[model samples]
Structure formats: C-alpha cells, structure tokens
Target: MTDTLTDRPRGRQVDPAEFAYADELAFLAAYDEGPRPPGWQLTPRAVVTFIAGSGGTAVELPTKARRKGLPSRLVIGQKFVGDRAVVERCVVTLAGERGLLLVGEPGTAKSMLSELLSAAVCGTSRLVVQGTAGTTEDQLRYGWNYALLLAHGPSPEALVPSPILAAMRNGAVARVEEITRCLPEVQDALVSILSDRSIAVPELSGTTDATVHAVPGFALIATANLRDRGVSEMSAALKRRFNFETVGPIPDLAAEIALVRRQATSALARSSSTFAVDDAVLEVLVTAFRDLRAGRSVEGWDVDRPSTVMSTAEAVAVAVSLGLAATYFPGDRDVLSLVPGHLLGVVRKDDPADGAKLLGYWDGAVRRRAEDGARLWRQLWELRDALTD
Candidate 1:
C-alpha cells in the first residue's frame, strides 16, 4: 500500500527515510520491470535510482494494473548527494549478500547511505544495532528475558532476538552503526553470522531451537568512522567478510551550499518559524566550511587544517542555528557576527589546538577575503574576537 503525506500524523518531529519516501518507493516498485534479487522490494537499478534520483526523467508506471491514487509517472527526488559510482558499488555488494562496510570520516553520511539502502531494498530500516564500547554479544545475537527464562528454561518463547537475528529470520537488511566501537569479541560475533548464515543458540543446544538460519535476501550494512579506526580495530577475520566503501564529504561548492540551505530551512520550518537566512549568508557559510575543511581557499591558498572534522553536515547545523536565531531573536544580533562564534564552537570540539587553527583561518583566509572587498568576510573578520574571547 502507498502512503501519502496526509496519511502521516502532523506535528511529528521526524520520520524515517522509508516512510518519508513511501510514494516514490511504491511507484518505483510498480514501474520496475527488471528482475530483482530474491526477497528484495525493488531491482538493483531501481534502488540506485531511488537514492541518486531518476535524473528528472519520467519513469512510467505499470499499465497492466494501475493502483488507485498512485502516480502514472514519477520524478524520483535525489535524496543523497555523492558519487553515483559509490552508490552503485554499494548496491551491487548488497545484491551479492556480502556484508557491506562503509568507513569514512564523521558526517560523510555513511549512516544515511546505509539507511537509504536498507529502506529501499527491504521496505524497512528498523533492523539496526548501534555498536558502542559497551555493546555486547547479546545485542548482535540474542538474549533471554529473565522472568520468562526462569519459567520456560531456554525455550524460544523466552528468547529475545537481536536486530541481526530478526533480520536473518525475516530475510531483511540489518545495520550495525559504529561497528569498530564495539569490543573485538563483540564485533567477532558477526564473523560467524556472516560466514555461516546462521547463529547457534548454545543455551538451547539440545533442543529444536538450537539454530536460526538466514533467509535468501538477508544482508548486513555496517558503518565505521575513519577517525576512530584504531579505537577498537576490527579483526582481520571480521574484515575479510565485508566489502569496504568510503563515503566522503560533498565535493561541489554549489551542491554543498544548496544542501545546507535546504536542510537548514527545513529545520527552521520544523520549529514553526520562517527561513530568513539569505543566499549571500549561506554562500559565506558554505565557502567558510569548504575552505576550513580543505585547509586552503578554493583558489588554493594554504591554511592550517583543524584536527576536528569540518564536514558539510556541520555546515548545515551552523546554518540551522543562524536561521533559528534570525527567526526568534530578530535583529538582536547580526547574522554575519554569529558565523565566527559558531565556527569557533565547531572547531574546538575535540582539541584545544583547534581553536588556534580556527584563529589562523580567520587571520589568513578571512583577512585576505576582507581585503579583496568581500563584505561578509570583512564582517566576519571584524568579529574574530568571538573566537579568542
């Protein structure tokens, strides 16, 4: 069944990507005349189209039996902004039922890509295990309800299946976020599941419920931060099970600016406020992010790169802050003046030395731009004390 915008309750804070794009997903599912892998909702080509968009081309729906209220043609909206090749490779990897691992710097949207893929392929992205240092084998495998376990003694009724196990049983995609954060042993729990396509329930070894087998379409998508690679490294055995893909920050300046503006404006709208941020202000925000993140101006002038990550996701956040400030405060402070302080907060996240790096950015890049007659940069340079104070 297709879900319409009106079908969803209003005043909700957030919606899953799958539900948000249900109509598009339904349209693609009907229009896709290609062969799909077993248990998948859409073909690999259609999944790619869903994530990267249909390039504004009209995808014709099935004429054999048109569902009421469904569109006869669809223009798939581009939800993800990155290399098309990267997404293609990810889709192919999942189709082969291999574990797909996305390793990248923070805020590169690795988790977002995983969610989109899972949603498109399986019709749900809820089967997830967030890996942390405290995550245990039980989270990746199964646990027991003490009350039920005491009474039932290792029966299936007493067992609580993990997301991984649930995905395996249902023939769906399962996600493990920050996989490297888990202890090596906890991470190793996946090695057996991926290799054997089944998990043994040792507690029920002598019973009929001793093993749970994965179905045909079952796959795993795991994400790890490149910045935390060595925090708790994955064992070679575990690494051999998955195809690794790296998701980088958005490359084009115009694309980055558009993304920041769109997301920030959406954030403001969610708060029941108008998006009053100007295009010029957004350009400054994106340009500053690009320059700081790359450690050089678009013209290639050298500057000190901060130890902390300066990703497009952070740029969107700062823009959102400025939008909200403009919405509520309304001239209590200048929008341009807030840039330096917001940037200071982003830069000084991990290392105190990052503050010096940001200051150097203001002194070098901002100063040069201001000298070149850029009004926004001049205003930002004037507020350099915001970082220091």
Candidate 2:
C-alpha cells in the first residue's frame, strides 16, 4: 500500500514476507488489472502467482503502470515449493471468505504458506495469534488495558484488541500458528468468530461498541502440525467452519535438493556469509533425508524411517549449518563429514531407536551404494562412524 519497503527500517535480521517481497506484491497488483474480491489487495489469479510464481516466464506491466522507475518486466519467484493446485485451493477458499486451515507435518512450511497467503491477500501478515499450551481465549478474542480498565471502568477506550480483532476491524486476514497447541476449550473461542463473524463485548453492552462485526473480506488462516497428535484436537463445530488443506513433504528429489540449496544460500547471505557447501554434498544430504523419510531408497532398498519427520525445513537448517561451519571454520573438516552427525541429530529428535535406524540405513543402503562405487555415497558410507563417534 505504501508503494515499496524502502521506507521501512532495515535493522531487523529477518523481515516479514510482506516487507521482503513488497516489489513483487506491487508489480503483481499493477500487472493484473482484473476483478478482485472486496477488501482484497490482489486478484485471485495474481495471488496464486504471488505464491506459486509464473513458472520461469517474465511478465511485462501494462502501459499505464509501465514507467521508468518501475521495471517493465519482472518474473515472480516461487516462494512455496509445492503443487500450484494446492495454492489455488487456498486462494479460492479465502475468496469465498471461509476460514482456511493448513495441516501438515512439522516443518513442511505450513506456517510459511499461511503467512504468504495473508500477506498477499491483505497486504500485511503481522496480524497473527501464535497458539501455545498457555495461549488463552483472550489472545484469540481480545483483552483490556488494565490501567485504563481500573481507572475508567470498562469503556471502549479500555479494550485492548488482539491481532485477530484488529484484522476483523480492518477486513484483513489473520493467522493462527500451531492452532492445535492451545487447549481445546481455549481453541473454541474462535467458533463464534468464524461462524458468526462477530465478537461480542459483554462488558460494553448497551454501548455503541457492544459487538464487533467482521467486514466483507475478513478471513482466518490456521496451521496445525500433523505430528502434534496428542496436543489437542479441533472440535467438530470449529472444524466444520473451515476448509482443510494438507501440506506434504516435497515428492520430487531434485526439487527438494534445489530448495535446500536456495534456502541455505539465502539464510547464509543474510548473515553476510557465503554458501560454500558443495552441490554433491547437498545432493547426498537431501537424498539421505528423502530415503529415510520414505523408508526406502530410490533403488528400492528397505530403510527404517525414524519416528521423526524428516521435513524439508530441517534439511534446509542442516544445509545452512554445514555452510556456516565451512565458512567460519575453514579447512578443519569436509562438509560431507558433517552430514551423518546432522542426520543423527535430526533422527534423534523423537526417539533413541531413531539413531539405531540411522545406523541400519548406513549398514544397508549406504553400504550398497558404496559398493556400487558412487563416489559421493562411498564418501558418505565412510563417514558412518561419524554418527556414533
């Protein structure tokens, strides 16, 4: 809305997706001159493009928006590396003003997709309620300014609005991260909001602000991790009001590798460090992860998948760690040598049995690949001792 992010502060180590990708949002807005849902920033089609990208094609702006200052042609980069169809469903759900819920295994980027959707649809992703075991109903609804409440006594001036409340008032989308983390009773607070699209203020009864109604374009996006089975369950009433989309791990190995490399490079660049980890090393890291996650190697060898979810996000973190170690330590160790320990660390997250599974994976598929003489696998196999050592 303010044109670009140049006016925003550059002090933060990590900026929100909205601030980081302001140009893309602006260009996409001007690029597509089409009908949009009320209170929406970009058209549905452009919103999809903003998430899934243009499939490597450059798009030129229309004559009216084309100018010297703005670039005439720009390509939208794919932020979420998954099916475009999944993204399309999310857009359609929001356009219909339905509460959209993204469910997935831990670290599959469910939260990232939710943030991207909120930012593209409403131009801001800051309106969010992070759900935790200690999260209260007031967090999803509203609280009050204690000082003002005690001094002035339950007036509209004393009401402290939550992010969800602010989003409703502004007709913008709000995000709820780890929605299942909150207690079931606490989570039920959203039922009235999603179903009625209004929040009642009993304290302000008979006042002009007795109830807050949501504007036309308002919606809520929630993310729940599949691995969080015992945390809490969504009530049938609460579940019925929302559309659920499951975000899965990347199915394609090459795409997953590329994603890890790009994300690790981006993360390293943020710290003014170089991504010195090799492509071969990255391929080995990702392939092992994929194999372990699926409980089978690409060659059909049996593997014991760990209790842990070998998520792509974790792979990126491991890649970034290797890059940082290589950049900072320099010549002390080969990046590939760090792979097994990292894999062990990722596997050990859930159970101790996962470590034995990692060793078994080494004894089986890894040894076979080494015997077959694939150079990288042989190097990885040689580092099997690195796991327990």
User: TM-scores of all models?
Assistant: 0.95, 0.96
Query: Which portions of model 2 miss their true places by more than 4 Å?
Result: 1-10
| RMSD values, in order shown | 3.5, 3.5
TM-score for candidate 2, residues paired by index? 0.96
Clashes of 1: 0
Q: Please give the distance, in angstroms, between residue 352's alpha carbon in candidate 1 and its true position after superposition.
A: 2.3
Regions of candidate 1 where Cα sits further than 4 Å from its true position: 1-11
Error of 1 at 155 (Å): 0.7
**Residues 185-221, candidate 2, lDDT per residue (tens digit)?**
9889999899899999999999889999999889999
lDDT of 2: 0.92
For candidate 1, lDDT tens digit of each residue in 1-389? 23475675555566787998999988888888689998899999999999999887888887973789788888997888999999999999999999999999999889989999999999999999999999999999999999998886788999999999999999999999999999999999999999999999988998888999999999999999998999899999999999999999898999888878878877787878877988998999889888888888987888898888999889989998999899889989888888888888998898877899889988898899999999888898888888888
Query: What's the lDDT for residue 369 in model 2?
Result: 95
Which candidate ranks first by lDDT, i.e. highest? 2
